[model samples]
Target: MDKIQRNERLSVIIKTLCDNPNKVFTLGYFSEMFGSAKSTISEDLDLLQKTFKKNSMGNICTIAGASGGVKYIPSVSEMDVRETLEELAKELSHPDRILSGGFLYMLDIIYNPKWVNKVAMIFATKFSGLGIDCVITVETKGIPIAFATAQYLNVPLVIVRHNNEATDGASVNINYASGSAKKIQTMVLPMKSLKRNSKILFIDDFMKAGGTSKGIIELANQFDSKVVGIGVMIETGLPVKKLVGNYHSLMKLNTSEMQENNSIDIKPNI
Candidate 1:
C-alpha cells in the first residue's frame, strides 16, 4: 500500500471509532494502521484530544494502570456520552477480529466491577446536585448502565421492558417507534417503580430514534413523575423530537457517512 498521510490517517482512525464505540485498541494496532511508531500514535491522540477540546467537541481519554488501553468516550462539549468508547474502537479495529450479530459485544466492559464502579462515580458526580429522584432505562441492555447511574445517584432504577409479561406483574405500557429497531414497540415500566411527583433522569445504553425514550417519559407522566435529564452511552445523530428536552449523551453517531469520510464521527457534545 502507499504511504498514509498523517491528517488522512487521523481522519480514518476517527471514523473507524465512530462506527464502533466502547471498543478498545492496542498501540500496536495503531502503528500498523498509520504505518507509524507507537510514540507517534500516542502523540497524535494527545493532539487530537486537544483539538477536540479547542473545538468544543469532546475527549479522547487514555486508561492506564494495568489492562489499560485507549478509549474514545463521547463526553465533554459537543455531546455528553460516556468516555469508554474510544478504547473500544481500538480493539474492534484489529484486522483479525470478528464482531458479528447485532450485539455491541460490550459484556467485558459492562461486567467489569471496577469499571462499573468508576462509571457510577462519574454519573453520581454529574447528577449530585441536580435533584434527581430516580433513574430510568429500557429493558435488557440498558439495565446495567441505569443500575449504575441509580446506585451512584442513590436513587431507584425504573426499568421499562419492551414487552409486557407476567414477570413484570403489572406495568404502564406505551407504543412508540424505535429508531434502532425501526419499528413500533411497546415499552412497559412498572407502576410501582416511581413515586408520584418524583423527579427522574432517563438513562440508556444507546439513543437512536429515541422511541423507547419517549415511552419512558410517558410512563413517568402516568405516575406523576417528571423527567429531569436523559443520559446514554451513545446517541445516534437522528431527530430528537421523541426525547426529553434536557438530556446527556456520552457519544453521538454520524451515520450520514460510514467510513467514506468520517465513519465514527466521535465527538463530545455536552
Candidate 2:
C-alpha cells in the first residue's frame, strides 16, 4: 500500500476519531495504518487537536501513558447552542404549532436529526459527569432524544412502553398519573431492561407538571435502580408545583404569553 500523505492522513484520522467518540485510539494504531512513525502520527494529532480547539469545533483529549491514546469529544459552543435554541424558541412560538389541547406540535422537530442531536447534546452534557448506567425514556416522542443522549454518553438506551408489546417478555408494570392529562396511565418496562442498583438517566421531550418524571422515579424503584438525573427538552413554566422537583430543562415554554393573536413565548433555560 502507498504511504498516505499528510492532508489525507489528517482527514482520515479526524473522521475515524469522530466516528468513535469517547473511545481511545492509540498512536501506534494510526502509525501502523498509514505506515508512518509514531512521532509523525503524534505531530498530526497535535495539529488536529489545535485545529479543533481553534475552531471551537470539538475536543481531542490525549492521555499520556503506555496504554494511553486520544479520545474525541464532540462539543458545540455555548454561543451556537444559545443561538440555535433561540431560533427554535421562535419557531415554537408559532400559533400553528399549538394544538387544541395546549400541546405543541413537535413530531417534526423530534424527527429532525439536526435539531434532535443538538437537544440531546445539551441533555447529555448536563448529565455526562454523573455515573449513568443507561439512558431511559418512554415510548413515542422521547425515543430520539433518549437515543442521542445515550450515543453521546456511550450507554445503553432503555425504553419504557405505554403498553406491554409482549415482545419484551416478562415485564414490570406500574400505573402513574400523566402530569398534563391528570389521568392514570400504565407504563411498562422489561424486567431485564435494567439491572438492580443501576444508575439511570431519564430523558424526555416534554414535562408538564412532572408527573411522568415522578412515575419514572417510582418505576426505577421497582427494579431497585436509582435515577441519577432527569432532563426535558421543553417544560411548562406555570403550574409551578410539579410532582417532580429535580430536573434540567433546555427550554421553558411560557403558555401565559398566549395572546389573542396566538403567540406563545419560548425562552431558553440556558
Candidate 3:
C-alpha cells in the first residue's frame, strides 16, 4: 500500500477521536492502520492535541501505560458556554413563551438539535471528570438532552419512566412528592437497566424544587448505585432551597416575574 500522507493521517485520526468521544485508541492501532511507525503516530497525535487546544475544540488526551492510549474529551470554552446559555435565555425569555399556567414554552429550543447538542456539550464538559458510568434521566422531555450527554460522555443512557411496561421486565418502583406541586408521583426503572454500584449522572431539562432529582437519588440507592452529579438546563429561582442541595443549572428562571408581570426573567447561571 502507498504511504499515507501526514495530512491524510491527521484528518482520519481527528475524525476517529472526535466521533468516539472518551474511547481510547492505542497508537499501535492507528500506526497499523496508516502503515506508519508508532513514533510517527505519536507525533501526529501531539500536533492534533495542539490544534484542538488552539481551536478550543475539546481535548485530545493521551493516556500512559499498557492499557492506556488516547481519547477525546468533549468540552466547550468558557466564552462559548456563556454565549450559548445567554442566547438560550434570550429565546426563552420572550413574553409569548409564557403559557396560561405560567410555564415557559421551551419545547422548540430543547428539541432543536442545534441547541440540544450545544447544551449537552456544556453538561458533558462539566461532569466528564466525575467518572460517571451512565447518564440517567426521567422519561419524555429530558430524554433528548440526557441522550446527547450520554453520547458525548461515551456512556450508556438509562431512562426512568412514570409507569412500567411489560417489555421492561421486572422493575423497581418508588414514590416521591413533587417539589413544586407537592403531588405524589411514581418512578419506575427496570431491574436490568443499571448495574449495581455504578456511578450515575442525572441530566434533566428543568428543575423546580428538585423533587425529581431527589427521587432520582432515591432510585439510584435502590440499585446500590450513587448519583455523582446532577445537571439541569434550567431551574426556578423560587423556593430558593431545593429538595436536593447539589446540582448545576445552566439558566435561572425567575418565577415571580413570570407569574406576576407576565414577563420572563431568565439568565445564565454561569
Report the lDDT tens digits of candidate 1 across residue range 1-270: 323567876787677654443355766677887678878878777877788768755356666645665655543331322344455444433433323432234566555675555445456556655788888877677778778767655577877777777766667877877656778788777666668998988887777777676777777788988887877766766564544556666556554534344333444443
Q: How close is candidate 2 to the true structure, as a TM-score?
A: 0.91
Candidate 3: global Cα-lDDT?
0.95
The numbered model that scores best in TM-score is: 3
User: What's the CA error at residue 185 for candidate 3, in Å?
Assistant: 0.7
lDDT digits (tens) for residues 179-253 of candidate 3: 999999999999999999999999999999999999999999999999999999999998899999899999999
Instruction: Compute the lDDT for candidate 1.
Output: 0.64
Deviation of model 2 at 258, angstroms: 3.4
Q: What's the candidate order when arranged by decreasing TM-score?
A: 3, 2, 1
Model 1: what TM-score?
0.58
What is the clash count of model 1? 35
Please provide, for model 2 over 1-270, each residue's C-alpha lDDT reduced to its tens digit, 9 standing for 90 to 100.
Answer: 234599899999999998876778999999999989999889999999999999987888899999999988777788878987898888787779877655678799987998999888877667876879999999889999999989887789999998897688999999998887889999999998899998999999988899999999999999999899999999988788888878888899777665333567789987
Using lDDT as the measure, the top candidate is: 3
Q: Which stretches of candidate 3 lie over 4 Å from their true place?
A: 1-4
Native RMSD of candidate 1 (Å): 15.8
Candidate lDDT scores, in order, read 0.64, 0.87, 0.95
TM-score of each: 0.58, 0.91, 0.97
